[model samples]
Target: MSRFLYLDNAATTKTAPEVLEAMLPYFTEKFGNPSSVYQFAAENKTVVDEMRKIIAESLGAKSKEIYFTAGGSEADNWALKATAEAYQAKGRHIITTKIEHHAILHTAEYLERQGYEVTYLDVDEDGKVDLEELKAAIRPDTILISVMYANNEIGTVEPIREIGEIAHEHGILFHTDAVQAYGHLPINVDECYIDMLSASGHKLNGPKGIGFLYIRTGVKIRSFIHGGAQERKRRAGTENVPGIVGMGAAVKRAFDTMEERTAREKEVRDYLIRRVENEIPYCRLNGHRTDRLPNNANFSFQFIEGESLLIRLDMKGICASSGSACTSGSLDPSHVLLAIGLPHEIAHGSLRLTINEEISKEDVDYVVDSLKEIVEGLRNMSPLYEDFVKKQEKNV
Candidate 1:
C-alpha cells in the first residue's frame, strides 16, 4: 500500500524511538542477569529498580508496591486469583462489572468454578457502571471489587474513585485493570483509593510482554509464580531487563508529553466523531460522549456487518478494529455492546477507532470519507437494509 493510516492505538502502539534506544544495550553489550552476584550482572538489577521507581511514581505508589509481570493479563490474573486465595478466609464473594476485559471476565469465571461467588453488575446504555447497583450488589461476604478503568471496546471511563469509595466503605479490596488508562489517563493510586492496579507497556508505546501490578502494602496476597526470589519474592522469574528499560522509557515519555499529546488526540478524535455522526446514516455513537478515553471513537452502523466493514477499511489502507484485538478472531458480537443494551444485530455492526498523537485531521478526513462511501455501498447490498427501504417506500 502506498499510503497507510493507523487508528487502532488501543490494540497496541508503535514503540517510541527513545524507548528502543534505551532498551538496545540490555540485549547486547549489557546482557547481564540481574540475579548474578557479579557487579556487572547485578548492575542490571539497579536498572530494574530504577524502572520500578519510575512506574511507581507515575501512579503515586511507593516503589516497593510495584511488581513486574509478563503483561497485563498476567498482572490481572495475579491480582484476582491471588487476592481471592489470600482473602478466602474473610470472604469468597467478589464484585465486578459485566463489561470487563475477557482477562478479568474469564478469570472471574474460573473463580466461580472454584467455589467463589461473583456478581457481574450491569451498566447503562452508555456502558457506565451504576453506582447504586454497585452499592446494592455488595454483601457481607464480598472480599474484592474489580473494575476496569475504562472500557477498551466502547471507551467508557468508569467512575473508579466512586467505586473505590464504595468498596472501601464496606472494607473490601479494590483492584482496577488500568491497561487502557495507565498512560492515557492521569491516575493516583492514593487519590483513587486503588488497592491494586494493572498496566501493560505495549498499551503506551513500549515493547510487548512487560507489565506491572501495584499492590498496596500489607495486602497479604500470595505469590503468583513460584521459583526464584524475583519481584520481591512475589513473582518468580528471570527479570526481563530490556523490556523493563523500554517500559520505563516509554512511561517517562508518555508522562512528560501526556498533557499536550492527549489534547491533540482528543481534538482529532472529536473531529472524527463529528464527521462520522454527521455524514453516516443509520448509525449510533457508542459510549459516554464526554466521559471517555481521549482517543476512542466507536460507532454501530445499523445494517452493515462489522467484519465486512473492517475488511473494506483495510483495503483502503486504514487500520481499525471491530472490537478488542483479543477477540477479533471470534465471530461473536462484543460483550461490551451487549452490556449497553444494544440488540444483537446492531452490536454486530460496531466499529472502534482509537487515535494516537500521530493521527492528524487530514487522516481522520480520509478515514471518514472512505467510511461514508463504504457504508453506503455495504448498506445497498444488504438484504436487511433493502427490506427496510421497501417498507418505508410502501408507507410513503
Candidate 2:
C-alpha cells in the first residue's frame, strides 16, 4: 500500500512482463526493417506478419485488413480523414457523437473545414447515444458514422452493434474508436457489422507507440501516410517490429484470460462503486450502472476541484485521473461529464478510476478509504460545501 497504486489504466497500462519479453528479442537480436529485401530482414518481416495475424484473429479480422499505426490517435485520424477523402464522391457527410476523444472530434472539425458536413450526435444522461436520433440524422449524402466503442472518461459502452446496423441499413460506412474497448471486451468485427475499428497497444498493456486499425475487406479508405510501400500500401512506414510483437503477445494473453479478468474486475469495480456511494456524501456516479466498462468507475464529488482531489490522491500513493489523460493538462471541465448532463462545477470535480487485471479488492478498499478521507478533508475547507450544507438544511 505504500507503493504507488495505479488506477489510471484507461490512460495507459503498464506493459506486461510477458509483452516486454516478447519484444526484447526484436529490439536487439531480431532488429531489422520489414521493408528490407535482405534475408536478415525477412525474418523480422515474417514475425511482423505473424503478429498481424495474431491481432487480426483477436478482432475476427483478416490479416490483410489490419493496418498498424503509431497509436490510437493516428488510427482514429486515419479512419476519419482517409475515409472522408476516399468516399467524398459518394457523400460529404459524416456523423459522430459529441463525447468522442479529441482525435475524433478534432478530425471531424477538420473535415468540416474541408467542406464536409458533420452531425454531432448528443448523448443521454447515461452517456448513450440514441439509435432513433442517429437514424433520423442520416441523410442520402451521409458517408460515414464514427462512434467510440467505450468512452475513455466515463467508461460508458455505446451500443456499437446497433449503431453499426443503423449505418449499414443506410449504406453508410461505420467506424468505431475502440481504443478503450479493444482488448478488454470481446469484439467480432463481422458479428458487430463494424466496417472500421481503431485500437492502441498501450491501452492493452503493450508498447505505447504501436496500434492498429481494422479495415473490413472491401472498405475503401485513402492512404493516411505516404511513403514506401508498407502495410500493403494502405499505411506506409517502417514497421515497429518490437512494438508489434509486444502487442501480439499482450493481445493473445488478453484473449486467453479475458473472461476471468473481466469478471474479477467487474466485481471489484461494482464493489468500489457501492462503497464510494455509501461512504461519500454528495457524490454522483458519472456513467451508466450496468452497461459500463468493467474497469472504469467515474464519480463527481460536489464542492471540490478534480485537480485538487487528484493531487491529494497522488499524495496518498494512489494515481487516478480527473478525465482523459490526453486532456489532463487542460483547465476546462470534462466534455464527457458535461455531455452526460453534469453541471460545470460537478464536471470540474470528476474523478476517474480505471482498474486493471493487476488491481485487487484490497487495493479497491484502500482507494475507497483514501477517497473518503480526501473528500471529507477537502470539503471541510470549502466555502461551497458550507453553503451547500446550509442550503440543504434550509430546504429541509
Candidate 3:
C-alpha cells in the first residue's frame, strides 16, 4: 500500500510543529492557573492575554471581544443561547440557514423545544441562502440570525455579510459559525456586520479542544458558562492555556503565509478535480467550482456507495470521507447536499476530499487514480449498474 494520502483536512488537522512547540512550556514548567494571584499564576495569565491580542488581530477584533471556550461547539452554543437569553423580550424568534453544521442546527432545534421560534431558511442549488427568503423570515419578533460562514461538507461560502446586514436592519443580533472559514479566508467583523462569531483552533493547524467567540462591542449576551470570573465574565473557568497559546501561534503562521498556502492548495485542488473528472466515468462534482474553500473537493459517483468507496480508499492508504464526520454514523444523506437539492440517493453516494498544505500533487494524483479504480470496481459489483447495462444492451 502507498503512504496514506491525508485529504480529509475538514475533519481536523494535524497540529503544526510550531504550534506544538509554542504550547510545550505551558504543560509543565510554566503550568499555573491563570486565575491565581501569585507571580506564577500571573505569568500564565499574561501569556494567555497576549495570545488573545494576537488572535484578535487575526480576526480584526479587539482583545476585549475574545472569549475562549472548549471548542467550536461551545462557542456556537454560547453564541446562540446567550444571544437568545439577552434579547428574548425583544423577540423569541431566530433565523438560520438549513445547511449549517449540526452544532448550530441542533442547538437551534433545542431552542425551539424551549419555546423559541426558529425559522430555517433553505439554500439554493449552489448552496447559497435565499436572500429573499431571508427577507421574508425576519419578523418583528426575530431576535437573532445565525448563519455558518461555510458549509462543512460541500465547502459553500455563504453571503454572511448580506445576511448580517439584513439582521441588523431589523435590529436583530447576528452570529456566524466561522469554524470552517476562519483561517481559510479573510474575515473582518465590522465589514461583515457580524455581531457574534465562533471559531475553532484545530481547523487551522492548532491543537483541538480550544476555540473563541467574538462578541462585538456593545452587543449583550448572557453568559453560558456560569462559574468564576474569567473571560471578563463572558466565559467562566480557568482557560486552556497551552491550547490557547498553540492557537495564537498557529493563527500567526497561517496569516503570515496565507496567500501562498491558498494558492498552492487551489492549484492542487483544481488539478485533482480535473484529473478525477477526466479519469472517472459518471462522476458529478458537488459544490461551486470557484466559491468554495480552496482545499475542498466533493464528488458523487453513480452506482457506487460512498461508504464502501471510503473503506476501499482507506485500505489503499488514501483517507477521505463520505461527508462531515458528525453526520457519518447515520445512513441518512448529508443535509448539506439535500439542502442544495440533490436527490437522497445521489447525496448518499457523495465523497468529500479536502486537501491541506502538506498534500502534494502526487498525493492528489494518487487519490484520483485510486478513486477511478474503486468507482469502476464498485460499479461492476453493483446490481443496479448490471441491470442498467443489461437494459441498455437490449435497447441497442
The list of candidate 1 runs beyond 4 A from truth reads none
Candidate no. 1 TM-score: 0.99
Off by over 4 Å in 3: 394-396
Query: Could you give candidate 2's per-residue lDDT for residues 1-396 as a string of tens digits?
Result: 476899999999999999999999987889989899999999999988999999999988899999999999999999999999899889899999999999999999999999999999999999999999999999999999999999999999999999998988888999999999998999999888899999999998899999999999999887899997899988888899999999899999889999999999999999999999998999999888999999999999999999999999999899999999999899999999999889998899999999987888899889999899999999999999999899999999
Whole-model lDDT, candidate 3? 0.90
lDDT of each: 0.96, 0.93, 0.90
Q: Write the per-residue lDDT of candidate 3 for residues 184-292, one digit (tens) a residue.
A: 8999998889999999999999999999999999998878999989989878888899999999998898889899999999999999999988888778888887889
Candidate of highest TM-score: 1
CA error at residue 354 for candidate 3, angstroms: 0.5
For every model shown, what is its TM-score relative to the native structure? Answer: 0.99, 0.98, 0.98
- RMSD, one per candidate, in order: 0.7, 1.0, 1.1
- What is the Cα-based TM-score of model 3? 0.98
Q: What is the alpha-carbon lDDT of model 2 when measured against the actual structure?
A: 0.93
Higher-scoring candidate on lDDT, 1 or 2: 1
The TM-score of predicted model 2 comes to 0.98
